[model samples]
Target: MKPVNIGFNNMVMDERIVAIINPDSAPSRRLREEAKLENRLIDATLGKKTKTLIITDSNHVIMSAINPETISLRIGKGE
Candidate 1:
């Protein structure tokens, strides 16, 4: 699997990513909370507000400050 940089030097495996969605909706927010409660939330925002949420196959949620579109581009590059 290729390693995709989410932002701020954080990287995630491209193959493991299930979905990347904006975290503004109620359901997304609830998912973030649930991930937090389950200890499966990874904050890669580095103190910044989360703009995107990366969901993994293992049910882990990764919070990122970068836009989802930009992350998608990086994943496409497969770098």
Candidate 2:
């Protein structure tokens, strides 16, 4: 599977990603919390603040320091 670099050398399977969302939304925050509670939150931000929330097909929420718009653009480039 093609990989999308989410920053700090962290990568996620492109095809497995369901949505790339900003963390500012109410629903997005709730989803992140739920993922944390469920132990399905993947923190790829290292020590930086999370800017994007990558929801995967397996209900996993991958947190990244990169902006959502930048990440979405990276998706189309197929790196």
* Backbone-clash count (model 1): 0
The lDDT of model 1 is: 0.96
lDDT of 2 by residue, 1-79 (tens): 8999999989898999999999998999999999999999999999899999999999999999999988988999996
lDDT at 21, model 2? 91
lDDT of 2 at 65: 96
Residue pairs with backbone overlap in model 2: none
* TM-score (C-alpha) between model 1 and the true structure: 0.97
Per-residue accuracy of model 1 over 1-79 as CA lDDT, tens digit each? 9999998999999999999999999999999999999999999999999999999999999999999999999998876
> Per-prediction TM-score, please?
0.97, 0.95
At residue 67, candidate 1 shows an lDDT of: 96
Best by TM-score: 1
7: Cα error in model 1, Å: 0.6
